[model samples]
Target: MAKNKDVRVTVILECTSCVRNGVNKESTGISRYISQKNRHNTSSRLELKKFCPYCYKHTVHGEIKK
Candidate 1:
């Protein structure tokens, strides 16, 4: 069980543009991504540049609390 905590964890990334600009209101849902990151290597929240289908552009996707 202790070893599991040290492994990469699954995280959800949400589009910053869609949330800040209220673009999700028009669409059925907001853009989200599932990824894994090393807990030991990346102590801080992860952010990545990803494509937002609703926004129709690439935007910064930040980690959200599960």
Candidate 2:
């Protein structure tokens, strides 16, 4: 028997505000999150609202290349 393929893939989400700002004013790093998405359900890039410690506010986090 062959192993089944995984339907869920891991994706990296990055803070949009931090990228646009070039650098975080309060911190020296960008906010990032790890999540899983269904390949069959969503083919497009994933975007979510999450809290950023560097930004100190909730912002849009978009999926990025690994």
Candidate 3:
């Protein structure tokens, strides 16, 4: 079986703008992305520039706690 402390793990990225604006009333949902990262390589939280459908522009997406 695979070890519990694998080098790569799954994480979720959420748009910062949408969350800060509280704009999830009528929209489908907040923009989120599923991605994998190497735990050993990067110990800090991951953040990337991604497209936000709700905001209709590129925004900073930060790693969220599982």
Candidate 4:
């Protein structure tokens, strides 16, 4: 018998359904600032939890690769 192991590096995200309540105009600036911060400093994925302004809830999902 062998132990099962699972590891992941990256996965597709559905960020269109996140509930954005506390987000403000300043967030827009912050997002832009972050992009500029990573322009040449590093190669990291700036994963954002964008909330859906319409649905008023966070509905984003994550799936494991097979």
Strongest candidate by TM-score: 2
Candidate 1 residue-wise lDDT, 1-66, digit = tens: 345454679999999988898776668778999999999899899999999999888999999999
| Poorest lDDT segment (10 consecutive residues) of candidate 4 | 29-38
Per-candidate TM-scores read 0.86, 0.89, 0.86, 0.25
Q: After superposition, how far is residue 48 of candidate 3 from its true place, in Å?
A: 0.4
What clash count does candidate 3 reach? 0
> What is candidate 4's CA lDDT for residue 28?
36
The reply for model 1, stretches above 4 Å from the true place, is 1-4, 24-26
RMSD in angstroms between candidate 3 and the native structure over all alpha carbons = 2.0
Stretches of candidate 3 exceeding 4 Å from the true structure: 1-3, 24-26
lDDT of 2 by residue, 7-66 (tens): 899999999999999966669899999999999999999999999999899999999999
Alpha carbon deviation, residue 19, candidate 3 (Å):
0.6
Residue pairs clashing, model 1: none
- List residue ranges in candidate 2 displaced over 4 A: 1-4
lDDT of 4 by residue, 6-27 (tens): 3333444333322234444433
Q: Which ten residues in a row have the lowest lDDT in candidate 3?
A: 20-29
Model 4 segments more than 4 A misplaced? 1-14, 18-36, 59-66
Model 1 deviation from native, Cα RMSD in Å: 1.9
Per-residue lDDT for 1-66 in model 3, tens only? 875888899999999988898876667779999999999888999999999988888999999999
lDDT for 13 (candidate 4):
38
